[model samples]
Target chain A: MVGIDEQDVVARPGGAASPRRVQRVPMGLMIPAAAGLAFLVLPLAGLLIRAPWTTLPRRLTEPGVLTALRLSLQTATTATGVCLVLGVPLAWLLARVEFPGRRLVRALVTVPLVLPPVVGGVALLLAFGRNGLIGRWLDSTFGFTLPFTTAGVVVAEAFVAMPFLVIAVEGALRGADIRYEEAAATLGSDRWTTFIRVTLPLVAPGIAAGALLCWARALGEFGATITFAGNFPGRTQTMPLAVYLALETDLQAAIVLSLILLIVSVAILALLRDRWLTAP
Target chain B: MIEGMRRPGPVVDAHIVVDRGTFRLDIRLRIESGEVVGLLGPNGAGKTTALRALAGLQPLTAGHVTLAGGDVDRPERRTWTPAERRPIGVVFQDYLLFPHLTAQDNVAFGPRRHGVDRRSARQLAADWLERVGLADRARLKPRQLSGGQAQRVALARALAVHPELLLLDEPLAALDARTRLDTRAALHRHLAEHPGASLLVTHDPLDALVLADRLVIVEAGHVVQEGDAATITAQPRTDYVARLVGLNLYRGTADGQTVRVGPDLALAVDDPLHGDAFVAFPPSAVALHSSRPHGSPRNTWPATITGLQRNGDNLRVQLAGPIGVAADVTPAAAANLELAPGQPVWVAVKATQTRAYPADVQPSAMTRDAR
Candidate 1:
């Protein structure tokens, strides 16, 4: 669509199939782009530079570090699972069904994406915590509370991360061809069968992308996880929280944790992007 | 599967009335088992709207649809069956063979949804693919299949359901000219084999003429003509139908052998018909003369050449006069006569070349009979 070959190679009189197309970046765009890249990469560079590489392996194997890292991975994965189950149906509703308050429902669905993570934690607490709305009934009925537990970490992470999955999946559903559904119906597929057999597979890439984003966001979550679930090392102290806690006593430990989180995210992103999202 | 002889009543019987903004489509249709009716119309004729209303994709504003002896949609009685519940299949214009599925799976989807087990469904799909002459391409996805191959897959998928009623919207319109010829022949075979009723919507006159058992021409949401291909082509009722069939036709009052088609214009026909009548003749019937020469031909008029284009091996000249008409001439004759636009020429037609019939049937009386 950009016609990169036409813009670059064809600009040269009759040079149609040049080995390399010289793409020019205007000074106005180039200067700001370079600055933006530097702004994002500088902190990661600093973390790597300050990392205690000599003791990195030993620190990574430490019980405290391993416990927090495991918790982070587990909570992030579980939260992504939760989002997939709940958010996908919500996305389908927003994309495929027409209702009186659909526009408002869609707007509300995206509220968590912009809401402060700390405020999100407070909202989750009031909704599901002790002596709160549904939490009171849950507490009285089951004697099971969510806050200050490992389960709370997943709940808090899911609450903060679900909007990403919902938005992406909804967009995918909206973009899918509705004519295929009609074809399926004519083939005698009920609405439920159509959704499971036709609609889901059609929007698989979007769901994958949304789940990835949700997982990544949940992995790095700090504000909501700590506020609602509390900073118990083995339960709620995820990588980001661990890094923040380590920063007070040892900068080297914090650098190592940050580097671990970065490596894991970048590796997963690179591998999945190539396998799923990259166009042939 | 639909039975050709055993069925007693029509496979589909419907009167669909749908209103979208100012456009209203009111059509009554009936199709006996094994009958393929081609719904032919110009753009914005509400052909697609009518198809959807019958398929239950869109709700009818009025009237009813009865398919396979069961009521499908009757707004007045509040009786309705959704598309999935109705025993119907639709081959969409683009085929819509699920891009993610193999050709086998695409065909199997219908059977599988209809409650056939997976392995048996796949077997049915293979048989269908073989019947459509795409057995070798069964493993390929829709994107990998050629246009013609995909068309077959769509047809197979629709038929795999064994629907009592089948709806095809512009089934062969997407293919290239060469592919269309073969595909049209194949589609004709398939439609014949399909014992259920079929209604195909198309703007291509050739597709309608060659594929349909009967042609139903609609214009501006109303039926303009309905008959067998030969009958419809021979006696096109409206100017749009006339143009589609490549005939020059006019309506006027008939006095004995001549019909006054326009002010100061009258054409002589072999048949003597009285009162309102229609006169029709092929473009090949008209002969052009550089000057007035009038012994053999009974009708002659001075006309100016408005346009000229190649129609097959002959040159089709559009003439403007009191009654506009098209005249086809050999390229040799066209060249020798110097047939260029704005050139004055004498047009002549033999009385025997034109046909005249009484114009007693009103436009509204012609229902594109497909129920």
Candidate 2:
């Protein structure tokens, strides 16, 4: 029976069923596919096998560990909120409006996605640091600075995570039927109200998926947060930053933090898979 | 000037002109209150563009649109009313009900936007749903509703706004044949009761005949003909309209009772009109013969059958000769005659069966004359 099941699985190429015959997979493809699966799974298995399981609970409860984890969660959530408020409208503008330089603007929006996180950190510092252009004016006028603060961690994370949210939401907006918007207009609803009532509800799933991805990206942010916010124990040091700092002094603690981050990320992705990843 | 000032025109009066790339649309229309005007046209004939321009969705490059004595769109004056501000409601071709909202919420959306309180908006939605006979299905999503039910909900949603002018774009085109009959009857009743002026755009002649008080036929972005259903069916001006009304049309020079349809073909019509004239007769009036027979009919011509198709219970044979014509024959008669494509046949019609009227130069006629 097991052999038959294995044969059945191997016979179905791309899950296509034939009326009278079953297709067989080529050995060349099967070997590489198995190797690819092992390539992805083996590193994760090693992490689990080498984890200091007995000291997990105690290490998790440590003041530094809890503080860093708490900061990471709070900042990631705050960054996601910021992305939602600003990114949704920007996505709408890029998707719906026609104007000069729109293509250039859209290309600029994706720059952060390709730019290295440490480079993004440097760019953010140049724009929002104490001695930077806007930062100097803000310091002189409002006596406030963003770099090396808890708020700076959120800023860096949002800078790195916003592109994912914008790209996803914009795709949803483009795919949505614009005729519904026209119908709403004919029903006496203005553009703004139509957007809020009709357009937003239609694209809610896309926004949710984008927000989840944005939050996940923000949670795993390390180089930008450390470079711009300067890793401080309770204020700016998030889980990834903490892992990096612990790698020098305590390998077990570093492994524990890494495990926690991996578990949270995987749980979120698993929870969202059924609703979003499999959507038509 | 005094007489013109005193004369009251239609509630909606407009001359709409739009330019898109190489295509230009110029159509003049007027609709009195409580009247339903159907804009019937073939595909890509600018019927939807005219509807969109009236709804303020498409901007006019030239001309103006006046609704209820107010200038809604006048490009010369730089005066334009946005679609939301215009007192018009449109039923899109696909019905376009919001997929995410329930039927009740979808209907209530307009009322809420116009500043009705939540309770009253829901109440208004309930009343409208009841009017459309869908109150029981108010909680269902759009996907849950049948096509006819969705169309009704769309109509109710548009009417809830209490617009001065209503536009329906191929309202019954999306329905199946069986559903269309029922939905058409329901729609005709609603249109009769509506107090506002309405413009319906459709390609189906039957829908226009049943639902419209007036029919305006457009072709190639121009208004080719406009009249009541009976007048349009009885006397079509263009070949497009003639084909739509199911008539074989011919343009020729008339002398006394005979109209020369072609160089060698002359049709004996009843009307004794002079100069350019049009002769029209139904395919059913045409009789096919295997050989020329001595008959009282004066309009007989030898023709070759080009095509044959089952039309209703009879076969409609397309004949091409000096004057192209369609002749309907019973299946037994067709079999007896052995009618098929490339078959030579003689066609005849009675003088009294053909109607003749003075012809006006039209775009289609001009092109045919050029050829």
Candidate 3:
């Protein structure tokens, strides 16, 4: 088949550079793919080219820089931990259950995936803020407030990023061969045991991929963190917020902060991806 | 109180009653321990449905399934054990082995799920692998194993559970000819050693004949015939079962010695019968000649050779004339007669050789037929 296609290409005018070969690629397919590739790669390339290489060491070692970086790492990791605990079961339910309004429920889970991060922060505030529904009751009853705190930052990041994990893991669950679960059942394993031993192990790669996606998305989240947790230095000022703050006063500092986040997220994703995602 | 009776072996006493659309399955069977029962049927003949019902994979619409005196399903009492809880093992047609696990781990799964510790479960799986003669291939995953080897691993995995009843659904159907022969021999040995009542569901007659002690022919979800191997082969109840037993069967009305088989053929049988009846004679019992033979065989008619093929060493000539039938003769005999498609020939069926029975046996007569 390869030889035949190559021969056909050779027979055509202009040989391999023939327009007919490229014409087979539909405009519908080419346009969107070109746009998507540019959208993903251009910003990364822009960051790398504009990074403050001479001031990199000084800016990276700044006291506030370390504090914001540490806080960002801590919050993102904690958010990912929360997602793994709650998102996996929710994903399994969405993928496997056949109840009424399941499609609506699935759409609701992915609402955060498509929603603007600021809107998600507002929604979270309305539900869990100081004067909001549960927040108001908690403030009156226990003198507790979930806004403008590091824990609040974690909650905001988790709310925005958990959908990525859930959707990815749910897709994996949907594609997985459910016969293995049935086979496990026939082997005398109950529903919970089969889910833990057979179903979970089979979809571990998917869970890892999703967790990485969630962590990266959370690390870069700005709107929700600044709105819900209120960007106080070293408290709610995650990497993206710090970069945004530096954007107004000093463009070079903004580029440096963006470069730091870019480097950290890319390095972490690459290392973990090789360790878990690419493996069997 | 003093007991004077001795205990018999475990027998699978099951009453399967299910309603699946237009087809209804109503079958009661008692498969003796250490005996292999073949549930033989056509594609839509509900053979697998019966097996699933017994295995607790499908719930019964009514009736009860008791394995060795333990009730597995009773719709009346709303007592139904799930498939995993039932002490029954199944070798599905595709094997359904866990592709991610090694052969040993796949076999160990059942034992591990049954609460055996890791070390003991692995040991049990190793023993089963050794028994199946695949101990050296234990570390190989299911994708690496051959078709026959995968089937054996599936069987070993099922047997590792030490089930009270074993159900094999087309265990050898997935294998090629040579593989099937070897797998059949291995399966026969394993089933012989297994002290549990086993039900082997297959449409292949050779698999039933070779691996099962009793033959139960189901048609459209009902047991058409159930007896020992010889009884089923000798006295097939339905035309489908008759074909499975390699008999050319025709349903006709019998009047004295002459039975009008088709529009042109009236075969004279030795068995006296009246009203509706069935006539059966094996292909080997039929003799084909170029001309009418001067023999004592009263059933002789002209036929056209419609098709011819080799059955074993003999040539099976499919004749179409007064009645459609297949006659097996030596290749030399066929050559001597110059047999070919569209050739004219005289067919003879011996009177004493033909067996005629009622179209449907009475319930009382079934007991006598069992003998």
Candidate with maximal DockQ: 1
Instruction: Label model 2 with its docking quality class.
Output: medium
* Candidates, DockQ: 0.78, 0.74, 0.51
Tens digits of per-residue lDDT, candidate 3, B242-348, equal 88889988888899887888987888998998888888999998998778899698899998999999899999889998788989999889889999999999999
Q: What's the candidate order when arranged by decreasing DockQ?
A: 1, 2, 3
The DockQ assigned to candidate 1 is: 0.78
Predictions ranked by TM-score, top down?
A: 1, 2, 3
Please write out the lDDT profile of model 1 over residues B1-371, one tens digit for every residue. Answer: 33332357888888889988899998788888899999999989999999988888999989889998878899999998999988888999999999899999999999998788999999999999999999999999999999999999999999998988889999998999999999999999999999789999999999998889988888888877887898888888899999999999999999999999999988989999899999999999999999997699979999999999999999999999989999999999998998999999999999999989888765432533544
List, residue by residue over B1-371, the lDDT tens digit for candidate 2.
Answer: 00122124566788889999889998888898899999999999999999999999999999989987789899999999999888787898899999999999989988888789999999999999999899899999999999999999999998888877889999999999999999999999999988788999999999999999999899999888887898789888888899898999998999999999999999999989998998999999999999995869889999999999999999989999998898889999999999889999899999999999888654342243131
Q: Which ten residues in a row have the lowest lDDT in candidate 3 chain A?
A: A14-23
What is candidate 1's lDDT per residue for A1-280, written digit by digit as tens? 5798768755776567665778888999999999999999998898788889999999999898999899999999999999999999999999999999999999998898899999998998999899779889989999999999999999999999999999999989998999899989888889999999899999898889889989999998988888899998887888899999999998888888889999998987896788666842
Q: After superposition, how far is residue A247 of candidate 3 from its true place, in Å?
A: 1.6
Candidate closest to the true structure, highest lDDT: 2
Question: Each model's number of backbone clashes?
Answer: 6, 0, 0
| lDDT (C-alpha) at residue B271 in model 1 | 96
Indicate the fraction of true inter-chain contacts that candidate 3 also forms.
0.57
Q: Higher DockQ: candidate 1 or 2?
A: 1
